[model samples]
Target: MRKEVPLLITILTAFIVILAFFLTPLAQTQQILLRWYAIIGGFAMFVGVWNLLKKHVFQVSRGKNTFYSLVLVLGFFMTFAFGIYSIVKYKDAFYINSPFMFNFNYVLAPLQSTMFSLLAFFMASAAFRAFRIRRLEAALLLFAASIVMLGRVPAGYALWHKLPLIAEWIMKIPSMAVQRGIGIGITLGAVGMSLRIILGIERPYLR
Candidate 1:
């Protein structure tokens, strides 16, 4: 009964959302449903936080990567504490120079940026293998990638006068055209998936 109820609700909601586009009167109904969706999503965030804390605390108790797990649990509590303090002290208006803001901007923000900066090196290594000139297509891709990568820098301009112009033309024309084609493909796939879900053929959430 529980599964059947959810499946029926899913089909009804999907149909209503689809109908809202052609039937103007259903648009307000769609907006109300969307707001309910937002409310449910807010609650879902707490569920996720609970799950994360449970997993990390379990790891800490089991002594599996205890240091990292303990750090995660401690960090979560410290962040939550400062965040609540900031909210109460500032009356829902967090200032730029607040303790929570300082921790986020200086500590967490730099850590995140450094992590992403390290990832760029790994990406470059992977790109080098993918951009190998083993075939005509690969060679062309390598050339295009080289031009695009270089043209954004001042050194590329110093190297050749027309290199940046060629790069700009390639990006604005061929790259944009390819992106539009991919977007259309993605839109079609999304429509197909939506139809499958509405028809009860793709019951992924049930699993």
Candidate 2:
């Protein structure tokens, strides 16, 4: 009975949601359902927060990487507290002007940027290692890659005037064709999946 009841509710909810999207007269009903979804999602966040705190606290208590765990907990609590304080105390100012934004801009932003900047260096190193003029295909691939990279950069245009033109042709023709083909394939696959779900053939929610 428990299983059957939940299955019935799920089917009914899916039917109502589909109807809400297609049937224009049920706009008010759709709004009500959306409000219910929002309320449920808000309550679910409390569960998420509890789970996160429990995991970090357990790690710290076990003394396994306790220092990092403590840092994680401190960061989480500090952000939460600052958010609450900003909302409750300074109702007029934007949250971006709060302590959260200050920490994010001065500390987190620079750290994140630095981490991602390392990826460019890694890519250059990997390209240098992988690129070899041993075979015709490998030589062609390396040449094309180098041309594309050079065409995009200022130094490439300064060194050779024809590079930008060749790069533009490659990007506009071959690259666009490949992109369109992939997009069409993805669209068809999504349509097939949606049809399967709508026809009750794909029952991922069922255990």
Candidate 3:
């Protein structure tokens, strides 16, 4: 009975959402569902914070990577406190020069940039492995990657007048075709998963 109730709710919600796309009458119901979604999302965030606190606190107590866990716990609380203070002071969490925004701009953004900068070395390593001239496909990939990299620079144009034109053609034609194919595949997978949930064949929440 517990599983049946949630399954029925899922099916009904899916129906209303699909109907709202084509029927004007159910659009308001869809908007109501979206509001419920936001409310549920707020509750989910609170649950996640609680779980994070529990996990990190246990890890800190058990002396398992205690330093990192302590750092995470302290960072979360500091960020939360900054957010609360900013909201109380200016009624806006991200007002310019607020402590929260300061942390975001200085601490978060730099960390994010550093993380992506580190990824460049890993990506270069992977590309080197993938671009090795072993098969026809790998040779073609190496050729395309070389052309695209060179085309973006002024020296390539100085060396060969047609470099930029060929690079643009490869990007617009073959690259775009592959992108579209992958996108279609992703969309179809999403649709299939949605249908499975609506039909009660996959009960993820119950698990």
Candidate 4:
């Protein structure tokens, strides 16, 4: 009974949503569904906050990595508090402009930037390791990569104007074609999976 009821609701909702998308007259129904989604999403945020609080409180109480746990809890609550304060008090400001902003901008921003910057070094190392002059295909790939790198920079343009033209062609033509093909494939796959779930053919979510 429990499984059947949920499945019935899912099928009904999916049908309504798809029908609303196709039928222009049912736009209001779609809007209502979107509002319901927002309400549910807001409630889910509260649940997430509760879960985060529970985990950190447990860690702090047990004295297991208590310092880091405290930092996590403090950061989370501080951000939440600032968000509330900004909404209630300074309603017109761009951001909260609280301690949260300072911490995020100064400390977290630099750390996050540094972490992402390491990716360039990792990519370089990986490329160096993978790059071998053993085959024609490898040579072509290397040549293309070198041209792309040179074309994007001022020094490369100064060295040769053809580099920029080649880079532009690669970026505009082949890159766009590949991107569009992947996007279409992904959209089709998503639609197929969604239909399967709506039809109750996929029920992994059901116990």
Q: What Cα-based lDDT does every candidate model obtain?
A: 0.91, 0.82, 0.94, 0.85
- Candidate 2: where are CA atoms >4 Å away? 1-23, 26-35, 92-97, 125-140
Ranking by TM-score: 3, 1, 4, 2
TM-score for candidate 2, residues paired by index: 0.77
Model 3 score (lDDT): 0.94
lDDT of 4 by residue, 1-207 (tens): 989998998898888888998999888987897899899999999999899899999999999999999999988877778666766666632364755566678878999999999999999988786676577878877887888889999998999978899988888887789899999999999999999999999988898
* Candidate 1 segments exceeding 4 Å error: none
TM-score of each: 0.88, 0.77, 0.90, 0.80
Best by TM-score: 3
Scanning candidate 4 in windows of ten residues, the lowest lDDT window is 92-101
Q: Model 4 off-target regions past 4 Å?
A: 80-119, 129-140
Q: Candidate 2 or 3, higher TM-score?
A: 3
Report model 4's TM-score to 2 decimal places.
Answer: 0.80
lDDT of candidate 1 over 1-207, digit per residue (tens):
878899999999999999999999999999999999999999999999999999999999999999999999999998888888888888553678677897899889999999989988999998888887598888889899899878888999999978899899989999999999999999999999999999988999995
- TM value for model 1: 0.88
